[model samples]
Target: MPNAAERPRRIRVQRDGPLIVEGPVEVVGEDGEVTVSHRFTVAVCTCRRSQIYPWCDTSHRRRRDRRSGPPGGEAG
Candidate 1:
């Protein structure tokens, strides 16, 4: 492996879930708003239902019909 300074950041994508990114990161929304995260690891939300936008609040864990909504379904 490379030394600490050369270590690569890692990102994980689940088969049916969010993108897990190594953190101390920031996300920019379409409206130009920024969301910052300082955690060692961050679960970036793919579904727009997170109350804590840009961060996964496990909202993708909810179940619903795929044909009617986003990933993990409509949550109802």
Candidate 2:
């Protein structure tokens, strides 16, 4: 078996927050557009209203709607 230190990256679900992703991950938009990014940390956009795209900018704090997936491109 491989050592834990050499394990591959994976995605972890946060109890009430964005999905915690490690290692390699791909992100796509509503139009099926793909984004390329390389970083240690990122908060994905679950509300689908973030102008920043695949990343979360905490816009969900004020969104009246909290539906998963997409919200017809509406911020709230």
Candidate 3:
């Protein structure tokens, strides 16, 4: 835990992306579960597409537009 005199941690909110937070960070879920990361920095998933919940695996970058068919522009 940080002391009262310690500076507040910084969290950067990326548009349509994960939240970049300075670590080590402790995340508490709605289920009263806790997720901890000791990395110097962590990307917290906001899109909820990551297989690893609460941790960003760049899944948001893989999002495909339904109207655009597929990556190769193949309509199936």
Candidate 4:
């Protein structure tokens, strides 16, 4: 039987950005370097803009994000 806790997780794509993963992982870069990291969460690049490649550096936030409301100078 496969160990449920040892299985690699598949990243899921959010509505606006790269896929988010939160389980066991084994990642390999194009240069053939491999790394295994365990965390409560992880993010994989989808837009291919990451300098580190395949990782989210929060760069996508600028392309897909904008405030929906007006300036808050008078909201107080």
Candidate 5:
């Protein structure tokens, strides 16, 4: 097995937040348009409520509905 430093970057899925990833990254839209980010790290939103699609801006942290939990909710 490779050492920790040699391992590839990971995607961390937050139950109530963004999908954390190492950048620079490109997210291609269905319309054949590509959104690019060049930061050292990126937060890809899972919640459909983001004002900025693909990239996260902490919109998931709000309480939109009482019936709802986190964006994707907790994983067993």
Candidate 6:
């Protein structure tokens, strides 16, 4: 097994989506507040629309579908 210090943390990025990171992870907000997750993997929000800040709740997907407009590029 690789030593914890020698192992690199993996993070997966998605276009218009959350960043998938290997955990357990700690996130510090602008206010100096810390958010911690102990899951095997975690989704960090990037679009800032998640009901649960820092942790993604797939809110970006909902917004993307709405902004794509209807068929033939017409938005009503």
lDDT against the true structure, each candidate: 0.73, 0.60, 0.81, 0.62, 0.74, 0.79
Candidate 5: tens digits of C-alpha lDDT, residues 1-76 = 1224455777887766788988777777879888988788999988867788888877766745667765456431
Clashing pairs in 5: none
Better of 2 and 5 by TM-score: 5
**In terms of TM-score, which candidate is stronger, 4 or 5?**
5
Q: Is candidate 4 or candidate 6 better by lDDT?
A: 6
Q: RMSD in Å for candidate 3, one decimal?
A: 5.6
Q: Tell me the spans in candidate 4 whose CA falls farther than 4 Å from its real position.
A: 1-10, 64-76
Weakest lDDT window of 10 consecutive positions for candidate 2: 67-76
For model 3 the local lDDT of residue 4 reads 42
TM-score against truth, every candidate: 0.70, 0.55, 0.77, 0.56, 0.69, 0.77
- Candidate 6 residue pairs that clash: none
lDDT of 6 at 40: 89
Instruction: Give the per-residue lDDT of model 6 (tens digit) for 1-76.
Output: 2236358889998877789999888888999998988898999998899999899997776665655765334321
lDDT value for candidate 5?
A: 0.74
User: Which is better, 1 or 6, measured by TM-score?
Assistant: 6
Q: For candidate 3, lDDT tens digit of each residue in 1-76?
A: 4434268888998876799998998888889898999898999999889999899988876785777656555311
Cα misplacement distance, residue 60 of candidate 3 (Å): 0.5
Q: List the residue pairs that clash in candidate 4.
A: none
Rank the candidate models, highest lDDT first: 3, 6, 5, 1, 4, 2
Off by over 4 Å in 2: 1-6, 64-76
lDDT at position 57, candidate 3: 89
